[model samples]
Target: MATDGIEAVFLETHNWGKSARFFQALGFELDFATDHSSGRLRNGQGAYVFIAEVPEDHKPGMQVVLTVPDAEAFRPGPDVEVVTPFEDTHFGTRQATVRDPDGRLWNLQAPAGN
Candidate 1:
């Protein structure tokens, strides 16, 4: 099945408070937060931003999350390259990663029970 649409843009930041405040200053409203470590923010038009503290030993990066009806059913065409296989995440979602021709990463996710 085709992907539904962009789900959320994820940001891995070293300073959660500083990054969150930066977005907030740009007019994004906080939708929810978890322990000041991670949060979901939304713009007036409904676009979402998901920020989380960078994990130890992991380099910070931006990830564009795409939503699909069922992650297991996603089929990358011959031209697309798979970086990671579909798997269940600790956050309770099914997801996979793929790399585009220029080497940019795309994260495909399906909500729990999808």
Candidate 2:
């Protein structure tokens, strides 16, 4: 099946509180925060943003995720590079990685199982 389109954004930051506040000031509300200084924020009915803290040495980056009703049923076109096959994520979802023609990586996520 085809993808459902942009779902969420995975943002990495060295300072979780500051990053969260930045989004909050933009009208996003906290959905939940993990004990390890990570959280998800939502604004209205749009895509949610997940902010996670990483080590200072790690370069912070943002990733856009596309949602599929079922990972097992999703099949990408030839132009897309399958970096990693669908796998289970620690957050209780099935996820896969694919690359665009420009070499940027993107995520495909689906709920647990069929």
| lDDT agreement with native, every candidate | 0.87, 0.93
TM-score of 1: 0.84
Which ten-residue region of model 2 has the weakest summed lDDT? 71-80
Candidate 2 Cα misplacement greater than 4 A, ranges = none
Report the lDDT tens digits of candidate 1 across residue range 1-114. Answer: 788888889999988888889999999999999985999999976549999998668898898898888865777789879898888899899898889899988998887775
Each candidate structure's TM-score, on Cα atoms with residue i matched to residue i, is 0.84, 0.95
Best by lDDT: 2
C-alpha lDDT of candidate 1 relative to the true structure: 0.87
Pull out the clashing pairs in model 2: none
Q: Under the 3 Å rule for N, CA and C atoms, how many clashes does model 2 have?
A: 0
Q: What are the RMSD figures for all models against the true structure?
A: 2.2, 0.9
Q: Which residue pairs clash within candidate 1?
A: none
